[model samples]
Target: MIEVHQFACLSDNYGYLVHDRASGETVCIDTPDAEACLAAARARGWTITQVWNTHWHPDHAGGNLAVKAATGCTITAPAGDSARIEGIDRTVDGGDTVTIGALTAEVIAVGGHTLGHVAYHLPEAGIAFVGDALFALGCGRMFEGTPEQFWASLARLKALPPETRIHCAHEYTQSNARFAVHADPDNAALAAYAAEVTERRSIGLPTVPMPLDRELACNPFLRADDPALQARWGCGDAVATFAALRAAKDGFR
Candidate 1:
């Protein structure tokens, strides 16, 4: 079995620890805070042996040095922007396979948030650690990539199996749900999910690790291809619909 532990860091960011029970191999996916990751590992009595980076963003890879110094863990990161990342012992790209004991994940080039952004997918485990490419009810802002590029990246992820549990890197679900409700007002799934998100956040619970299928039904960004929605939003096609939605969300409260 694969065990995962999630914790908060640097305000809204999240850090993750993955453990493969069969081989007792533990890995940390992106290091928002090395201290938080180390502490989480210590609490579980698990020793981290590897660190897998999804991108070169400072918030995600900033703790690489500290984590390596403390755990002596090997670091594998994206080769797309290796020049920007530090302490990467091994670099991989889209379609490359990485391992955690017996489990393997394919590195998906999900570049939109960053040129080197990647997503780790363990198909057998029915889970993925998508950095900033796809969010719960939203997608990442078009910072370093084009709207069309971001749309393409999102389309790849949206096609994944429905049951795939997405482990994104932030706690932006509440805000995303709000934007979703506004963008896709007639979507029953979005409305219900917004209510649920409101309740969960009211009590201080994390709203991550969401199922992909639910997001497909509720997330406005994912519905850009729907002909009805496209007409409603005054978009000519999926790409244009995506741009309109992203632009709207950028200025949304």
Candidate 2:
């Protein structure tokens, strides 16, 4: 069995340690800080054998060398931006697969926040490691790719099974839900989810790994094309609705 351990770092960034109990081997995903990753591995007595990066962002890939130096792990990243990413031993694109003991994760290109961002989907395990592509109740800001690209990427994620556990790279659910409320005040599901997230934050608990189906129902970004959301944003056009949702999220807090 594979168990996921989340390590909070760099304010809101998250690093994950996926462990395969059968082999006592672990894979660290998006090491925001190498020290934390090392400590977590040592604490669990699991050998870190691989490092998987979702993109070339410093916060995500900054600690690659340190982790590899400490653990002698192989580093893997998307091939599209390998030139920008330092210390990558293996470069893979969409449709490539990475193995962890008995399990395998398929690479899915879901760029939007960055030009070459990607996600790892393990269908048998019902889990997805999406860096900055899909968040709990929001999507990544459009830094390089266009709205069309973001839309296409999200649609690809939406095609996954409803029960897939979405592992995002940040803890932005509460803030995202605040914008969701502003985008659609009449949405009972959004209101209830926001309240729940607020409680979780108050207690220092994580509000992530949300089901994809729940995001489809409550995330304003995913509902950009919905008729009700378009009407609430004071526009019937699809692009206008998406813009309004992003604007609302930008000014939510």
lDDT of 2 at 245: 71
In candidate 1, residue 91 scores what lDDT?
Answer: 97
Show pairs that collide, candidate 2: none
Top-scoring candidate (TM-score):
1
Tens-digit lDDT track for model 2 on 128-232?
A: 999999999998887787777777788788889998999999998887887778778898988999999999999999998889999989888888879988877
User: Which candidate tops lDDT?
Assistant: 1
Give the local distance difference test score of model 2: 0.87
